[model samples]
Target: MAITQIYLNLPVSDLEVSKKVYTAMGGTINPDFTGDTSAQVVFADAIVVQLMTRETFATFTKRSTSDGPIEVISALAAGSREEVDRLADAALAAGGTEPREAQDIGWLYNRAVDDPDGHSWELLAYHPAGGQG
Candidate 1:
């Protein structure tokens, strides 16, 4: 079965702050699927992020909602190196933090940013032509 869409459910300490971070990265809030305790941020037709309060997130899982070590790094592909920089910079200016320095290896460029609650996101661009401008 081909997966038509993806939903990333993240438990956050502060719901409003999380929403702002996502919006800064170019996502739009979908009010139809959003409410007091949870929000749906649409990055693309096929990509959606479900940001929920830690208390609300507990309802969907039997596992603990306690914060811990890094569990996942969500990656987004950009059309070019400049696009990657634009998105990452926007996120940073809107209160997100840079997790590391940007990386550029001719064919690939990437930058990592972390939301206020520590959720990591990597913005990347790949050029198969190998450094071709």
Candidate 2:
């Protein structure tokens, strides 16, 4: 079967605060999917992100919030490594801070940045063919 969409359930401590940060990161609000307690961020027509409250999030997961950065990173693939670098550059210019310069590793190019809410995001470009432009 082919995948037509992807839904990312992200945990947030505060709904209003997270919404503002995501808005700054270029996410558009969809009232059709929003509710009194949650917001659905549409990254693309086929990609949706559900920002769930912490309490609701904790109900399903059995892990505690870590004191340091999250152990795992989530990345959305870019069409090209140049697009990855461009995205990182734009994000940093738009108040996001870069953890480091975009790095290239043969087939992968990636950069990490913290959104306005301090959520970490990796802007990545992955080439399955094992080469870089």
Candidate 3:
């Protein structure tokens, strides 16, 4: 079966802080699927991020959550290099941390940011034609 949508589930330390970071990254909270211990943030119509308290996240599996290590790095595509910078800047302003310097290679530009809970996100703009402009 073809997958129509993607839901990324992450364990967060602070629910409110996670919400603010996602909002700054251009996501909208889907209240219909949100509750006290969990929240659903929609980035695009087909992309949804489920943020849960570490306690609540344990209900889904026996795997342990670690605050020290990054298990995944989620990347999002932007329409332009400026858009990538905009989102990254917004995320940093909303309590996220920049993990590294921005990367630009003529055809692609990207910046990485980590949320308050330490979830990593990469904002990128790719132009297959070799140059952004």
Which lDDT tens digits does candidate 2 get at residues 1-133? 9999988777777787666655554467889988767899876788777877777767778986434666566676778777776767766776677777777887888889776546688878786888773
Angstrom error at residue 67, model 2: 4.9
Report every candidate's CA lDDT. 0.91, 0.72, 0.91
Best by TM-score: 3
The list of candidate 2 runs beyond 4 A from truth reads: 1-4, 14-17, 20-27, 55-71, 93-95, 116-118
Per-residue lDDT of 109 in model 1: 90
Assess every candidate by TM-score: 0.94, 0.66, 0.95
lDDT of 3 by residue, 64-115 (tens): 7876666689998989888888989999998999979999888989999999
Cand. 2 TM to true fold: 0.66
- For candidate 3, give the lDDT of residue 10: 92
